[model samples]
Target: MTYQDKVILITGASSGIGKELALLLAAEKARIILSARNEAHLLEVQAQCLSLTPHCHVLPMDITDERQVQEGAASAIAIYGRIDVLINNAGVTQRSKLIDTSPAAIRKLMEVNFFGPMMLTTALLPQFKAQQQGQIVVISSMAGLFGYPWRSGYNAAKHALQGYFETLQTEQPIPGLSTTIICPGRIHTDITYSAITGDGSAYGAMDPGQAHGIPVDVCARKIVKAMRNKKKLVLIARMEKVLLWMKRYFPPLFYFIARKGN
Candidate 1:
């Protein structure tokens, strides 16, 4: 399927993978609707997208806030009449060990990474059902597939996200209503610097591995391809792939690797 004229709404479109995806889809002539908490950054991305496709909208929204999410989707629907695709890319990560992490921090991470997207997807369910066809793309992490060090909270949030959406994909009540979860190992982004710490503050540290991960544009392109193919799940990054392989075929080795690393 082509993206031409498709009205696609992407959260976290202010920067990184979301911004790249917006530009890529815009080039394909899709009606791009951008959402994020950063209005300035959103406007910047909108300008770039509008250069490629005339139908570009910037809707500043914090997905963690349920009200903003609902209102944002309503506003998008008001403009476009229908949404063909919804990309849930807005999320937060954690950098502290589970024990050092504050309860409040875990709750906040869950709110941003899990509940926020879940709420938005539920809000748009009726619209999708009415349209008779829609795609839901979730930006889960490799952490969602396997445990990693100093990120139990982040891992937990992603794991829950995977469970919830994968289940919905299985129970797909209507034909053409699809779900695709994209799990990236590391796509060089600001996520590291902005990752929440044990005390609920930005970690302010960018891991070397993340700083040098696969390019964001490449990741965005792959995700778009997966969405077009309506793939159930896609994983990127060699480390993540290996970990999943071990987890599935060699449980003992998976535990051994996890323990040695984390």
Candidate 2:
């Protein structure tokens, strides 16, 4: 679908994929609503978006807060009339072994990565159903598709998202309502450094896989294309894309290799 003048709300808009996506969509002439916890950073991203597009709104929101998420959804509708798209891009990653991760840390990840998006989506669903036309894009990860090492909690959260969105897609029979789940192998984002650690501290360092992953702009562009096409699941990055198909059709081999990594 065309994005011109379409209202799109993106969480985690301060930096990384969300920031890049805001810029990309703004250039497409979409009305962008930016949301994140850091008001300062939201302003920073707003400035960047305004430089690119004339229409942009900044809504400082902490997705972890259900009240704030509901309010933010209302605010976006008030500002733009209707939300054409809701991008569940706000999420946190954990980089720790299962045993190393504390119960509190696991809860924190689940709150931000799973429950936060779920709440936001539920709050917005009424609006979408009323409009009878809306798109929900989930910025999931390859970790969601397969179990990975040292990321049990993170994997669990993303996996949950995949299940939820996939089910939503199946349940939604209306041609106008849609969902897209993006499984990116790795993108050049600071997610690793910002990832929560076992001790509940930031990892504070980039991982090699993330550093060498596809560029954020490239990944965002691909996602936009997939969203417009109304794809249920889109996997970017050649290696990871291949791996996803391998895991689906060649489960035994995938499990064998995956076990070696573990």
Q: Which 10 successive residues of model 2 have the least lDDT summed? A: 253-262
Report the lDDT tens digits of candidate 2 across residue range 104-168. Answer: 88888889889999999999998998899999999988889888777888889999999998989
Name the lDDT of candidate 1: 0.90
What CA root-mean-square deviation does each model show from the true structure?
1.2, 1.7
Q: What is candidate 2's CA lDDT for residue 179? A: 94
Q: Candidate 2: deviation at residue 3, Å? A: 0.8
- Tell me the tens digit of each residue's lDDT in model 1 across 54-93: 8999888889898998898799899889999999999888
Note the Cα lDDT for every prediction shown: 0.90, 0.88
In order of appearance, the predictions have TM-scores of: 0.97, 0.94
Candidate 1 has what TM-score?
0.97
Candidate 1 lowest-lDDT run of ten: 253-262
Clashing pairs in 2: none
